[model samples]
Target: MKRPSAWHLVLAPLALLFALPLLWLLVSSVMTNAEINRFPPALIPSGIDLGGYRYVLGNALFPRWFVNSMIVSAVAVTANLAFGTLGGYAFARIRFAGSKLMLGMMLATMVIPFQLTMIPTFLVMKSLGLIDTLGALIIPSLVTPLAVFLFRQFFVSLPRELEEAAWIDGCGRLRILVSIVLPLARPALSTVAVLTFLSTWNDLTWPLIAINSDSNYTLQLGLTTFQGQHHTQWAAVMAGNVITVLPVLLGFLLAQKAFIRSLASTGLKG
Candidate 1:
């Protein structure tokens, strides 16, 4: 059998170090309120208690909040992928007057912090009469500069031979993009989808600003209110956290390989 490398000696402990907090959260979720509040903070429970899970499931608004988050994330991810692909393809393949200046200006937006733009964005949403609705959340995130930049980079890296051959066969740009290029662009697609999903799913600040109605609240915003509503219920709070984080963790674990591959292929990994 092959021996393990020396790096394993350092990494094994670090892995445990990172996992410990998640482990404690899971443990605490199953503990009773009394167990959680005990002196020294009980690390193990005497018996399983489903009360935390019960509280969350039985709350009508919590489930509604989960659904709201799913709706916004699904729409945002789909929109970003579709439009980012089109805009990126244009930048990568088509020659247009002022294209370089336009691309540079678009990329420049990425450096400006969200803090500076938040008020202006809020004013725009208010002007459109989208405030207090899910539309406010979906409109702004339809596409992002990073998505366009990544797609442009990946599309540029593709060998022109493929597109040229398709061109010889009388295939138009759209047909080539849909039928030829996209098939080989899975790594970039996966990276974009996973990133857009994570960002949209975990977003709280925007939802907090846009959604004033209880029915429109996303899970993160709802959870913030949940904690305030039931401050003493540590177990329930931990349970809510687990529920909130589980989807993102599972999603990243499933797509991490493709995500990493996309980074390397696009020259961003370096």
Candidate 2:
């Protein structure tokens, strides 16, 4: 193992500062719902209780919402990885008329806030009879412009020699992409996958607009049901919030190495 750099030492405190909130959430979740609602929030739990987890998992709609979120995130990640890579490769390696214009248009779409297109997007989904369905969530987020951009940037840094070598080996473009280019593009692929998963998992607005059925609700959307116009269950709400956040936290923890390596590799490529 290598020794820690001076910069690592200097940044240790900053890292902890950023992580404190997450640590608090994890700790608070184990506390009784009553403990969480108390004044001057309890940083430590008196006793670990599974009640919070029970409430969230046992809720009539939570399990369905969980499954919905998982499906959306999984499908979105797969689409982003496949289409984003192909799109990125085209933008980086392929030459054709209006290629630059098309990329620019895609980038322009990213600039337009989702809020501006929310109603129109919802209307489109409704017209397609996709309302109250997972298709509405999965289709719109299948491949985002940002994912394409990230992959394109990373792909540009790759040497053309590899693709050419694959061609010399009598591999077709699709075969080269699948067997040669993709294997080496793991860093960028991991980055795109992690980002797409996180975004689709946490997305609330589109799900709220697209899904009206309880069975199709996402974790974020289901969490909102814990709140009422007249009375809010703060404890259960916090519990749900904790439940909603756990998968993201666990996913990041398990994939942090790949994620950071991707960023570092991309930065060096730039």
Candidate 3:
């Protein structure tokens, strides 16, 4: 028989410690309200009860909120991939006047806290008449500095020989990028898509500030309606959270390998 490693023994408990809350949430979701509030709490439910899920799914407003979230996330992910990749490629391969200065400025903006710019962003949205609309969420999240940086680094690592050969064959920059660069950048693209979708889907604070109408609320924002000053529905909240988290969880699982590879390689050259 093989002996267990010391590292495994050390990591086993830490893994479980991190997973305990998710396990408790799953267990509690299937317990009755009374049982959930019982003394000492129950790690295991006596019987499975899906009343919480039933309540959340049965509500008409929940579906609308879910659809709204889907729209925002999809749009943001598409825009991020398209624009971020284009900008990154330009920064990596093109030698234009002020290109380095512009790239440096964009990177610097990433360090400034979003809180300091929140008010200015809100005013810009108000000026564009996007407030109280899903556009308010999607427009601002279209691209991010991190996504651009990731793509730039990945592009910079690719051999210039491929692009040079394409140029010799009379391929324009755009054509070369579309035919050669993008296909080779699947890992970085997948990483950017998954990250953007997760961030947009889980965002609540900005949505709360921008959207006032319940009809315009995203999934995260609508979930807050379940809470009241006098009473809170814990079971419903947990169920809603599970539903909201499912898509992001599935996305990560599908792209886990590519996502990790992209992140690991992002700083390799730039």
Model 3 per-residue lDDT at 186: 88
What does candidate 2 score on TM? 0.83
Note the residue pairs that clash in candidate 1. none
Best by lDDT: 1
- Winner by TM-score between candidate 3 and candidate 1: 1
- Model 3 off-target regions past 4 Å? 6-8, 229-232, 261-270
lDDT agreement with native, every candidate: 0.89, 0.83, 0.86
Best of the two (1, 3) by lDDT? 1
In order of lDDT, best first, we have: 1, 3, 2
Residue-level lDDT tens digits of model 2 in 178-227 = 88889999888889998788789988889888988788888888877655
lDDT by residue (129-247, candidate 3, tens digit) is 99999999988899999889889988999999989989998999899889999999987888888778878999998998899899999998887775541135677678877887788
What range of 10 consecutive residues in model 2 has the weakest lDDT sum? Answer: 227-236
**How far in Å is the alpha carbon of 171 misplaced in model 2?**
2.3
Residue range with the least summed lDDT across 10 consecutive positions in model 3: 226-235
Better of 2 and 3 by TM-score: 3
- Candidate 3, 50: how far from true, in Å? 1.6
TM-score of each: 0.92, 0.83, 0.90
Clashes of 1: 0
